[model samples]
Target: MNDPDFPRRIRDAGGRVTAARVAVLRCLAATEEPLTPDEVLERLAQTAGPVPDRVTIYRAIEWLAAHGLVRQLATVGRAARYEAVEDRETHAHFQCRGCGQTRCLPAPPPPLPPLPIGYVAERVELVIHGLCAACRAGERR
Candidate 1:
């Protein structure tokens, strides 16, 4: 899904518009699930058109995440993952310890207690780890 707004977002975020940037944003926009850096590179290489190198994709991911266009999620003992924040609200992520499946969960309750003075909250991310439905079902069998 080539998104027109991706360009505007890049421009608005003071980022240079380039093919690699656009391609990376497009790749993120096309998926709802978070992607690892390696996965992103594999996806680009799998396409028919010319693909950016792994270094290029990695840089793009960093730039995009820094610009607030993408959200980065990292869980304990797991590689970092990223998801494009287009048309999606802030929320948590859940990963199944049994099957290693990850999915987005609803956001934590808003109006959270104030942070300590001098500490500014830029973003909040929570990770809930547990067995998923299928895994739970399988465990019972």
Candidate 2:
């Protein structure tokens, strides 16, 4: 999805407007589920012609993640996946153990128990794993 305000968003975050960055962000924004670097490259390649090189894609992913523009998810037996966080913050994801498909789920900040002194939390990743609707239906039949 080509978000019209992407350029401005990048600028507001002190990043220069560049083709690779824009393309990568658009790729991330286009999908509901997070994408791995290889998947991102594929998406970009299918769009026009040669996508950014592997190194460029890596850099773009790192940059976007560092800038809080995307969220990174590392599930078991899968390369890290990235999802655009342009809209909301602090949500959960549902991962299907049966089909390995992941979906975003909205959530308010979860209540937490008191923590020990001198410890702070940075990022929260919540994944609910089970059979998705289709997978569950397949099991039923």
> How well does each candidate superpose onto the true structure, as a TM-score?
0.79, 0.79
Q: Which ranges of candidate 2 are over 4 A from the true structure?
A: 1-4, 136-141
**Candidate that scores best on TM-score:** 1
Report each candidate's C-alpha RMSD, comma-separated, in the order given: 2.6, 2.6
The deviation in Å at residue 39 for candidate 2 is: 2.0
Clash pairs detected, candidate 1: none
- Taken over the whole model, the C-alpha lDDT of each candidate is 0.82, 0.81
Q: What is the lDDT of candidate 1?
A: 0.82
Candidate 2 structure quality by residue, lDDT tens digits, 101-139: 877786665677777999898756778778999999999
Q: Which candidate number would show the highest lDDT if scored against the true structure?
A: 1
Residue pairs with colliding backbones in model 2 are 1-30
How many clashes does each candidate structure show, in the order listed?
A: 0, 1
State residue 122's C-alpha deviation in candidate 2, in Å: 2.0
